[model samples]
Each structure stands twice: as C-alpha cells, then as structure tokens.
Target: MADEENRKAVLARVHGKVQGVWYRGWTVDTASRLGLAGWVRNRGDGTVEALFAGPADAVDRMLEACRRGPSAAVSYTQLTL
Candidate 1:
C-alpha cells in the first residue's frame, strides 16, 4: 500500500535498566523483524540509543516493541518522537 512506503524516522534514547541488558541486540532484532532500517547502540549514561528509519507504520511498531522490550529485559523506555 502507499501508506507503507511513506518513510518516517525517529531517534530514540531508551532509559532505565536498558544498558547492559541486551537492549541493543533486542532492538536490532525487533527492528529487523519490523523491516526497519537503522542501528542501535549503548550509551555510557545507562541508556540504549537507536535511530529507526523506515515505513511509518513499521517505525511506529518498532517504537512500541522497544517499549515492551524482548523477554525479561528490564527496560523502562522513554523515547522522543
């Protein structure tokens, strides 16, 4: 659909118990599954940082997924849209 092609982007910094919690790897997998194109990395200030660029819906889904995180990865995410 045309809507799926509409690109969107967001730079998110997820905080709280995110660092050293495999958050970056979880983000990468989640993003990939959502068909998003971006990268994730850990910040020195105890956060997980990522840039998600893709179809608008997919990007949105990725953000939501990041909030819940992947299984037992204690993360309280705070992202900026």
Candidate 2:
C-alpha cells in the first residue's frame, strides 16, 4: 500500500469528567508510545481534543483506547480522516 493510504488522522473529543483528570497527558503519552505525530489539548467546553496521525492500525488502537479513556474519564467521541 502507499504511505498515504497506510496513514490516518484522527480527531477525538472526549467528554464526561475528562478535564482535570490527566486525559491530555495520557493521550500525549499514548500517542508518543504508538509513534503517532499530533497533539492533544483541552477545549473550552470541558472536553479534551486530540489530533493523531500515524499508521492506520496504531491509530485505530489509540482510538479504541480513547473510547474507554483513563480511569477518570467517562466517554469519548471520535472523528477519523
């Protein structure tokens, strides 16, 4: 497959007690560990936002993890590209 086809970009918005719960830190660490290139930040609406670009499978794994989130987080909504 082509490099572009093997890569993907994901935008995730996590909700339900995600803020002030180390969500961003966990996301950053996970992304780094997965060799993803992107960033995670807090939104003004009490949500955590992240952009992840990496191998398709790795990105998908990360997205799955985001759905459950850390112990403190409750839920997540993701958009993939």
Candidate 3:
C-alpha cells in the first residue's frame, strides 16, 4: 500500500464557536467530498477534535476550510492545524 504509506495524518483541534454549531456536519461533508477519511467529535474542553488521513494537499485544504468554519459557527473559528 504505497499510497497508504505516503498518506498524511493529522489530529486537529478546532477552537471557538465550534460546539453546538453544524461544524461536525460541515466537517463530515467537506471531508467526504474531499475524499478524506477521519473522525470528529466534541471534546470536554469545548473544542472539536478530529483525526484526518489523506493526501497531504487535501488535508491542508481541509485544515484551511476548518479555519473558516460553517456559517453556524458564530464566533471566529481558530483551527489548530
């Protein structure tokens, strides 16, 4: 699995206005559309935690989109990529 070996993985924590918003849904949709694989969930520290695995470029794009989260995210979202 050369592709798997070359795949990139990241555990990202998103902060600010992420909880109670459609961030998870948006993330699932976006990640799936980007052909990435990952799992996202709400953390006790009021942050969104996610593990993304895919091409490096796609992962970077996902991280960028996370920074500019869904419109539902009231406050500014800061994605810790």
Candidate 4:
C-alpha cells in the first residue's frame, strides 16, 4: 500500500500528573474504542508514552483526547503525526 494509505503511527509523550492517574488505561480504552492498535505505558520520568497505529483520522482524534485526558489527568503535551 502507498505510504499515505498505510496506517500511520502516532508517538505521544504526555506530561503533567499523568502517571498513576489511569492515563494508560484511558489510552487503551480510547484506542480500543477507536479500533486503534498500540500500547500505552508509564515512563520513568513521570510521563506517559503511547504509540497508536491506525487510520490517520482516528489517531488524530485519539491525540486530541489525550490533550484532555481522564478527570485525574492533566495533559501537557501530545506529539503527533
């Protein structure tokens, strides 16, 4: 498939009080809901890193969701495609 047609990968580094705040779980849930394939993990630096591979639009939406994560989270960054 053409590069543009192929699924894109989104690498995100979320900051603020993200760790231990259900950020990863929220990411997993949101990605799953959007039919995305990837994983979210807690970083040693108190950040949350996630990789989302799927349609560009879905990935973008997921990133936007990351910007305003769950009630316990305070998103500070979202590096996208």
Candidate 5:
C-alpha cells in the first residue's frame, strides 16, 4: 500500500457548463476507478464542487480529468483547499 502521508486531498470548484452534464457521474466513475474517496455535488451558482482524496498521483489525474468533463465545456477549475 502507498504511504498515507503521500496521499492528497483537495476541494475543487469547476466552472463553465458543468451543470446538467454527466460530470458528477463521470467524476464518480473516474474517481472510483482511481480508488479515490470523495463526493461531487452541483452548486447553485452554475458550478460543480467536488472533493477528491487518494494517492497523490491519482488525485492529480482526477484533477486533470476535471478540466474536461464528460460533455461539459469546462472553463477552469479552482482548488479551494
């Protein structure tokens, strides 16, 4: 198993047309496949918020994937924490 200290967790807010798309579902599937633990939810301000936690590399990969969500034109991703 990877070192627990090597893991990373982040809270991010995705911008653009992320709503109504399958971004959340895609995130869940992608994150799950990556063995990540987190949750994704839609914000009222036309954005999507998600928490990703897992191996550093896996989390990084998930962040990259969020840049271009499923069928969603992502403008940018903001890491809150």
Candidate 6:
C-alpha cells in the first residue's frame, strides 16, 4: 500500500483529437505500468476523462505524457480537479 500522505490524486479531462486513437488503451497501459490506480473513459464531447492516483512524481509524469499522447498530431487541454 502506498503512503496516503504522500499519494497524489487527480481527475483530468483531456481535449483535442483524443478519441478513436487508442488514447484510453495507452493510458491504461501507462498508468498500470506506473502502478497508478485510476480509470479512463471517453466523453460525448470528444474528450478523454481520467483519474490518476499514486505518487506525485508518477502523476506528474503521467500528465506530461498525456500532453503528447500517442501521436504527434494529438493535442491536449487538461483540466484538473
């Protein structure tokens, strides 16, 4: 178990060409590899919604990866909650 005091959690919505491009799959794989606890899904507005929970450093790395996603053509506008 992670130390809850050091754990970080974020809920984010990623926008721009994130649908139908294996974004969710990539996210699942990446987050799992990072040992994060989270869920990801697509929204009706063509955005991807995700929750990331783990070490702060890992979460930061995940957010950075999300900025580029799986393709160079992909763009992101992340809103965190």
**Best TM-score among the predictions, by candidate number:** 5
- Per-model C-alpha lDDT, please? 0.82, 0.86, 0.85, 0.88, 0.90, 0.87
Worst 10 residues of 1 by lDDT: 70-79
Return the TM-score for each candidate structure.
0.84, 0.89, 0.84, 0.88, 0.91, 0.89
lDDT of 6 by residue, 1-81 (tens): 557777899998998889989999999999998999999999998899999999988998998888889873285857677
State the lDDT of candidate 4 residue by residue for 1-81, as single tens digits.
Answer: 765696689899999999878888888999999999998889899989999999888988998899999999988766855
Ranking by lDDT: 5, 4, 6, 2, 3, 1
By summed lDDT, which 10 consecutive residues of candidate 2 come out lowest?
72-81
Runs of candidate 2 with Cα error greater than 4 angstroms are none
What clash pairs does model 1 have?
A: none
Off by over 4 Å in 3: 1-6, 74-81
The per-candidate count of clashes, in order, stands at 0, 0, 0, 0, 0, 0
- Give the lDDT of residue 65 in candidate 1: 85
What is candidate 2's TM-score against the reference?
Answer: 0.89
Instruction: Estimate candidate 4's alpha-carbon lDDT, on a 0 to 1 scale.
Output: 0.88
Leading candidate by lDDT: 5
Model 6 residue runs over 4 Å out of place are: none
> For model 3, what is the error of residue 36's alpha carbon versus the real structure, in angstroms, after optimal superposition?
0.6
TM-score, model 5 to reference: 0.91
For model 2, how does the per-residue alpha-carbon lDDT over 1-81 read when each residue is reduced to its tens digit? 698899988887777788888888888888899999998889899988899898999999999999888888887675744
Q: Comparing candidate 2 with candidate 3, which one achieves the higher lDDT?
A: 2
